[model samples]
Target: MDDVIIPVAFFLILAGAVVAVAYFQSLRNRERDRQWADAMEQYRVVVERARTEQEATKLQLVEMSHQVKALEKLLLSVD
Candidate 1:
């Protein structure tokens, strides 16, 4: 009876420790997942901003091209 009691107590203690470690690990994983989601959202915003800037730049270049063509026609008429 004494031997059985000792083994049972040891087993219970070990099981409790294992459960505690697993619980903490799960919490850590949840925090990591949240961080990853936030980073992805930030990345998406940055990409959208870059796309908008690129479109604005493209419009400016097109406007500049048109202005240059108008100038060239003016010079030809002067000649």
Candidate 2:
């Protein structure tokens, strides 16, 4: 009886340790996942802002070109 009881107790203890380790690992993985999601969201916002700025710059370039053309025509007329 003593031999059987000792092995059973040891097995229970080992199982409990395994369960504790697994639980902590799961918590760590969840935190890492949340951090990754936040980083991705920030990257998306930055990309969107950059695209908006590029479009605005393009519009400004178009307006400047029109102004240059008008000035060139006026100068030619004066000559």
Each candidate's lDDT (Cα)? 0.99, 0.99
TM-score of each: 0.88, 0.86
Q: Tell me, what's the RMSD of every candidate?
A: 1.2, 1.3
Which digits, one per residue and each the tens of the lDDT, describe model 1 over residues 1-79? Answer: 9979999999999999999999999999999999999999999999999999999999999999999999999999999
The per-residue C-alpha lDDT of model 1 at residue 1 equals 91
Report the poorest 10 consecutive residues by lDDT, candidate 1: 1-10
lDDT of model 2 at residue 32?
Answer: 100
Native-referenced Cα lDDT, model 2: 0.99
With a 3 Å backbone cut-off (N, CA, C), the pairs that clash in candidate 1 are: none
**Model 2 backbone overlap count:** 0
On TM-score, the candidate that comes out on top is 1
Q: Model 2 over residues 29-53: C-alpha lDDT tens digits?
A: 9999999999999999999999999
